[model samples]
Structure formats: structure tokens, C-alpha cells
Target: MIWVAIAISVCLGAAGQIFMKIAMRDAGPFPGLIGVVDIARYFWGAILSWPMLAAIVSYGISYVVWLGVLSRADLTLARPMVSLGYIMVILYGFYAGERMGWERVLGIVLIMIGLFLVVRSGARV
Candidate 1:
């Protein structure tokens, strides 16, 4: 039951990140630190955009869901599950525009191995 909750949080977290990236693409790079409002306004517009709006709502729900998971699970277990988000980020990056190479693939494999060990070890606790 805890594991299931953990999985949901990780997946939701990953989806949140992907949605953020989609939002950022339209939002553009962060503004120079002339005024805080400058950055805030840019983000405000992004938040209003359709893709970003959806992303915001999704992440909002995900965050609430994640809090519930955290209440039931240990930090050790919950943190490891977030590695799943990194995997999702990599895949989304490639799909969005980033180049995929052998090194990236290797890194993904390593992350998966480490995450697997973390989860396997958690099962014992």
C-alpha cells in the first residue's frame, strides 16, 4: 500500500516536471534580475497559457497527492521514488528537443540501477 502511494507520487512528480518544461518553452528564459516583478510577470503570462495552465493544475494536484504519500512513507522510501522523476525528465527532454546520446543512455541506466537498489532495500524495511 505504501509502495503504491510512492509510485503514484513519483509518476505525478515526473509528469509535473515534464509539464513545467512544456510551460517554460513558451515562458522563455528567466529574466534578468533588474526587478523581481519582471520575472514574476513573465511567469504570470506563462501560467496563463494553455499548456502551462494545465501543467499548473496538474502539479497542484500532484503536490497535494504527494503530501498524502509523504505522510504515510519514510523519507528514505519517498526520496528514492523521486528518481523515477529524473527518468521521466530525461525522456521528456529528448522528446522535446534535447539530443539523445550514448552518454545520456548510460546515465539513465545507472539511475535506474540505483533506484532499483533503493527500492529493493526499502522492501526489506
Candidate 2:
């Protein structure tokens, strides 16, 4: 059950990142450090954006699940597990027409190996 909650948190975090990336596509360049009014307009646009809304909701639920995961698991084990989100996000980027260079592929492979080892040792502790 703890592992399941951890997975939920990681997956939702990845989804949130993806959604935010999508939303940012339409958000023109940063409003800059000009003033609060410009910043508000930029933020208000994000709030009204559907993809941004989904990202916010995803992050909200992930945070709730993460609280449960932290309560039940060791922080060392749980923190590294969050890297699983990196794998999901990379996969999503690939799916969204992004190039998957060899370096990224290698990085994903390494993360998988590390996660496997972490989980194995954590099972003993």
C-alpha cells in the first residue's frame, strides 16, 4: 500500500509536469520583472488554461498522496523513488514528438537500474 501511494505520487507528479509544459506552450514569453500587474495577467491566463488546471489538480492530489507515503516510508527510500517521475516525464516527452537522444535513453536506463537496487535494498530495511 505504501509503494502504491508512492507510485501514485510519482506518476501524478510527472503528469503535472507534462501538463504544465503543454500549458506553457501558449503562455507567451515571461511578462518580465516589470510589475505586479503584468505578473498577475500572466498568472491569470495560466489559471484559466485547461492544461494548467489539470496540472494544478494533479499536483494537489500528488501532494496529498505524498504525505501518506512519507508517513509510512523512510525518507531515503521515498525521496529517490521520486526520480521515477523523471522516467515518466521523459517517456511523455518522447510521445509528444520530442527527440529521444542517446544520452536521455542512457539516463533512463541508469535511473531504472538505480531504482531497482534501491527498492531491493529498501525491502530488507
Candidate 3:
């Protein structure tokens, strides 16, 4: 189904973000444009890191998958559905030892609600 491909692409994107976050733990703030030396510290090491590499590949594949999706679906309908990735990444954080409070829980629930409506409505909008 088209929805299945959409879900795969969304999951790939969310997983990429999660992998990048894990790879950057303790790396501190991103270096400024003027901080060339600081940038160097994060650059090569990150490019060589397995998690970062995985994230890059994941994102690359997700983009490819999205191109296929665009050919078969309405962008307006499919774009909103992509918000499912936000919910997935937030839940990943919660389960990965990050502290999730009530507000975030509510926000996730609201995203689910909106996604549900979007699916039910099809491409009518």
C-alpha cells in the first residue's frame, strides 16, 4: 500500500534524526561559522562515526523513498502525514532515558489525533 511506503519513509527520517542525536551526545553546541577549528572537531569525527553514517544513509534513502511517494500521492495529503515522524522521534526520546513531561505527552497525543483526521479525510482538502 502507499501508506506503507509513507510509513517507511517517515520512520527512516525519524530514525535518522534519533541516530544523529545519539551520535552527537556530549559534543556540545554546534560550532559557529567563524569557528573553523571548532567545526573541525565535530566534522571528521562525526562523519566517521557509525551512528552518524547510519543517519546519513537513512536520510538519503528516506529522500529517495519520498520521491517515489510523491509520484503516487498528493503532496498536500502526504506532507501532513509526515508529521507522524515527529511523534515517533518524541517517543523514541522518551524511551531512550529522556525525561518526558505531561506537556510533551499531550502534544504527541494531539499529533496522533490530527494524523487520524488526515487519514480519514483522504485528499479532499
What would the TM-scores of all predictions be? 0.78, 0.87, 0.87
Please provide, for model 1 over 67-112, each residue's C-alpha lDDT reduced to its tens digit, 9 standing for 90 to 100.
8877877777677777887888899888878999999999999999
Clashing pairs in 3: none
Local accuracy of candidate 2 as per-residue lDDT tens digits, 34-99: 999999999899778999999999999999999998888889899999999999999998989899
- Which residue runs of candidate 1 sit more than 4 Å off their true CA positions? 29-41, 122-125
| Better structure of 2 and 3 per TM-score | 3
> Which segments of candidate 3 are over 4 A away from where they belong?
26-35
Each prediction's whole-model lDDT (CA): 0.79, 0.91, 0.87
Candidate 1 residue pairs in backbone clash: none
Task: Give candidate 2's whole-model lDDT.
Answer: 0.91
The model with the greatest lDDT is: 2
